[model samples]
Target chain A: MGESLRIYAKLVGAQGRAQASYRTSFWLDLIGSSIIVGADLIAVLVIFSRVPALGGFSISQTLVFFGIALTAFSIADLVVGNIERMRNYVRMGTLDAMLIRPLGVLPQLLANDVGFRRAGRVVYAGAVYVVALSYADIDWTPGRVVLVVSAPLFGAVFFAAFFVATATVAIWWVESGELANALTYGGRDLTSYPISIYGGWFRRMFAFGLGFAFVAYYPGLALLGDPDPLGGPAWLGWASPLVGIAASGVAALIWRTGVRHYRSTGS
Target chain B: MGLVTATTDRVTIRNFAEFASLIGAIAASGFRRFWTYRQATVAALATNTMFGFLRTYVMLAMAALTPVVAGYTGPQLAAYVWTGQGLLGVVMLWGYADLADRIRSGDVVTDLLRPIHPVLNYLAVDLGRAAHGMIFRFLPPVAVGVIVFDMYLPQDLSTYPLFAISVLLAVIVCFACRYLVNASAFWLLDHRGVVMVWLFVSGLFGGLYFPIRFLPQWAALLIWLGTPGPSMLQAPMDIFVERDPFRVQLAIVGVQVFWAVLMLWACHVVQRRAERKMVIQGG
Candidate 1:
């Protein structure tokens, strides 16, 4: 484990230096991503400006979900996004080289192109989160504090699992980018709003079927100490962190199966 | 008329006609380029369809909050979402940094040396792409929307012609705005940043998000961003929903036309200036 950690640090350090070489591009990327967050924030602000609430949640409350979702997704994207390149690597027959490496295939891929450009999203998400907490009007309690603090941590795990599992799917179907987007980008967009606002089928598919609801919505309810407006116990919100663990386990199994399939087929 | 002057006049008319035909050919080629990309168009259509449903729900949900928010009735809001999805690709209302890439690769010099006006040629290509987008990208999404959401259309035959005219103008304005964004690459060198910002704000001001009218605070500000931004997607769309009176809708088209002219003029000026300052970087 110590050796693995050292290798990762070295790889990331090298990658960071390369990225730092393009000073202007680096700044532009940061600002470019921040603009996306800015646009979403504007949409939310505009909608709330006309409506008192959406799905029985106030604008401030909605921000808590948005904040958690964005931050968590940002964390997941910055790290596991490299895994998505597995498609191209596989197609180019580069996996043969990776398979020969003494270090694990997952770590090498994870450390291949680590970048800080996602910090742009982090900046905006952090800002929105801070603003949300300020206006959240929640009673201060230790349990709530811990939940709020850990929300992004759990959400990141949940999202990272989504990315890894989706990337694993790329081993079988190289054209899985769009299908994968249904969970990654699509799921992120879905989580930005209160799930109760969505229709019954839409709610069922994303919330319960995919378990993405654990990433932000359920966790958000837990932090707010609010009941689930979608006819479920409010405490269902606390299940996200556990769901994140479960997702990671499933993602691992899928990744192993994919690797085994690749080796057996020797493609 | 003198023999030389008469000959010159004849030559000038012939040249103008030839140029028009050249542009038409380029436009056709542009159309074919988009049509050829069958998979990309389908993939993009799928994404747009997905967003169409999401936005429809979001818009209707917002409309449900108030019987009317910013003069958009629930049906009107639904119309806006579905039609916006159709027009999204048709307008290509996003940053186009192709000129920046050309500049980076030194290919822009070839364009500069061409006898044709660079802006006009690019406009031809874009118009062709827009036509292709309308046929392939716009129709599929709208058909789905009509089936699923009961999207609105004008009852009057007159409205169709006017809407068509508005859509054409919007396409022109969209092209001009994108051209201008690309032109800035000559000066900025790193045009992606500029293009990114343009695309990000255009959706807000361009009515890809909620209607600009919903943004009372920002409506004046958006209008002040000058003509092309609002004239492109937002105005044509406002006309589509029949949210405005006929004359008012005609006036929106008028805004689009006026901006299209101004923006086209602006593109020519930028191309001329870029040629003057021709600095080739990292070919």
Candidate 2:
């Protein structure tokens, strides 16, 4: 395992260095990527401008949700987001090359093109998360403090699982990127706010059916010491780590099945 | 004298007829070219519709707090979100880099060699793409909104034609804005930074994430008067929802017209200057 980790680090390090070689272009991309987080933050602020609270949470409370979601999504996107390019690999017959390598296919693909540019999102969102925590009224306990520190990490795992699982679908369907985006990015957008703002089947499907509620909503509730407005159990807020592990298991199984099922383009 | 005047008129008419046919042919080709990407169209439609639901819920939540926020009631906000989602594809606020690519590769010279002006040629093609988007991409989310929510619909009969005109001007203005950004490649040789800035500015100020009316009145007025951003999406959406009074709607359309003309003129000047520089890379 140590050897594998070292090899993966070397591979990803090479690519990162190559990208950073273009200092001006790399910095521009980094700055440009951060603007996406800025835009999303502004959207949240605009909605809060007219109303004191959204879905029974104050602006600072909602910012906690937003910060967690954005930070987690950014970390996931920075790490394994390039896995979505599985379609390109399958289409261009590059998966065949990766299959012959000693490294695990998932690790090799994860290291294929690490998007260091997305690091800006992590920094930006992390700053926002810090500021939000300062402003939000929280009853700090050992458990609450632990959850605050670990929630985004667990949320990252859940979202990373989402990226891998959805990307596995591209092995069968090459043009499924945007459709996958509907779930992956859609889930991020959904979790950025209190799920109570949504109603009917949409809320149930995305929040409970897909396990997105555990990413930020329940955790935010745990942090803010509020019960779920929809009457979900209070313990649900602490279930993020468990949900993340379960999601990772499911994603790994899906990825294994997909890799076995892949038939190359045979060009 | 009468005979000479009639002959000149006939010559001008013949030239106009030929130009019209040229534009029609280019636009038809653009429509057919985009139609070939069947999977992409479907995938984009699905994504757009999903975002429509997400945005609509957020807007509805805001409206629940107050009867109206930023002069938009619940149904009006719903209408704005759905139509803005639909028009997102039609106006195409970003991701068009074909001109920049051609400029970088030195293939844009071929465009200058063509008989028609490059601006007009590309504009025709974009109009064709917008027409295709209107049918395929614009209608589905709107149809979903109508079915799922209590959306605002215009009661006035004339609003239909007025909205159409507003949308058309918006397309032209947006195409001109993108053209200027792409044409920067003639000088920089790689205008990716420009494209990135364009994406950020246009999406934020262009009212894609949320309505510009949601901003402070002074800021909104400045964007309206100074930039072509809001004229691209917000004006048409407000017109479609009848968010403003009739005179204000007319004024909105009028501002769109001014921006459209000014932008097109800017594109013309930029293209002329670019032709003079004519730096062909990678010979």
Candidate 3:
């Protein structure tokens, strides 16, 4: 395990060097991505102010939600920046090199490109969360603080699992790249919102089927000291991280199956 | 001479068959490509989905203040948010990234040498991707929206024709605007900064994140006429919601034609100037 981690570190270092090599393009991308997401967030805040309160939540509460979701997303992008390049690796036949490396293949793949572009997102999210903390009415408890930090970790694991699952299918088929994007990108798009607004059945699918609700919505409910937006049991919020872990496990199993299949297929 | 003509005809047929077969192959390959990188696909989808979640929460929080704004309910608002997010992958006709890369790599010259008109080829490629993207990106969100919220699909059958026309117009206008932005690369060389400004301005004027109707009346009117964002998105949404066939049809087709003609003229002017500039720079 330690050897695997060391290998992962070295791979990550190489990717970081690659990004540093193109300083201008890297900075431009980082700024551009940040501006795009920042604009979206500001637009929401502006529009929300025009209305009384969105979906029965106060401005303060909404701010907290955004803060939490953005924080999780930034961290996810930061860690899995390299994994997102699975398609390019597959198309370029670079995955073969990683497979030949002495370490576990997944770690090398995961560490290949830690996206510094997401640094902008992480900075912005951290700022928003700080601002939210200053204003939000939630009780200040050790448990709450732990949940805030850990929420993003679980969110990252859950999302990374989604990424791995999508890429594993590449072992069998090349065109699966676009199809896999539907799940990962589609899930990200769906989860950024308050899950309750999507209606009960949609929430149920995320909660029970895809298991994304655990990372954001249910935990969000627990943080708010409120019932689940989709009428789920209140206790599920505390247990939501387990769902994230389980999703990761399922992704790993699928990945193993896909890798075995790949070995057999000789692609 | 007769034999030569017959052989030429045969060659043309064979080339057409090859082209058709290539397209089919790419389509088939796209599916497997997506399946293979399934987790990465999920990550991309999750990125979009996460945005949807944040926007929905914001919209829901806003709906608490008012029930109806511009004739849309809370669920309808949520539908628009998710649908627009879905459309991002579809309507990505002209990404500034490509323009920057092409310019930096000096590949724009080769693009000019293509026999079939560079602009048309670009449009064709974009349309193909948009066609595929519209299916995969949108179907899930729309389906989820329908099953979850029962958001209204057009009830008036006649409105479907109007929607189709509006969508076609939207596509043309969007493509033209993209070309205009890309053409800037010829002059700017490094269009990164300029494209950023353009995107920021368009997002505001285009009703990308929120409908222009939410803007104050005078500001919204200015946006409607000039920015071309409403033409790309809001007009279609209007058709879906109001089904005001006469006004909707007129608005879509008329504006699309105007933008297409205007943009083509701009492109012609730019093309001449850019050719001269490139010769001077030995680009």
lDDT of 2 by residue, A1-267 (tens): 999999999999999999999988899889888886688899999888888888888899999999899989999999998988988898899999999998999999999899999899899989999999889978899999899979999999999999999899888888764777887888889999999999799988888988999999999999988888899988998999999999999999999999999998896
- Candidate 1 lDDT by residue in tens digits, B41-83: 7756777777777777777778768888788887778788877
Over the stretch A1-267, how does candidate 1's per-residue lDDT look in tens digits?
A: 998889889998999889889899888988887786687788889889889988788898999899999888888888786786887777677887888888888988888887578777877787888888788887778878888878888888989998899888767865444556657776777788888777767678767887878888887888777888777787777788888899999999999999888842345
The complex in candidate 2 yields a DockQ of: 0.64
Off by over 4 Å in 3: A1-7, A46-55, A229-235, A263-267, B1-67, B73-117, B120-162, B184-208, B243-245, B248-253, B281-283
Give chain A TM for each model in order. 0.94, 0.97, 0.87
The Cα error of candidate 1 at residue A96, in Å, is 5.8
Candidate 3 local lDDT, B22-135, one digit each (tens)? 555554554454345445445445555655655555566566567776556777677676666666655553343554467668787666655334565565555565555566
Better of 1 and 2 by lDDT: 2
**Ten-residue stretch with the least lDDT total in model 2 chain B:** B1-10
Q: What is candidate 1's TM-score against the reference? A: 0.89
True contacts kept of 1: 0.35
Clashing pairs in 2: none
lDDT of 3 at A67: 71
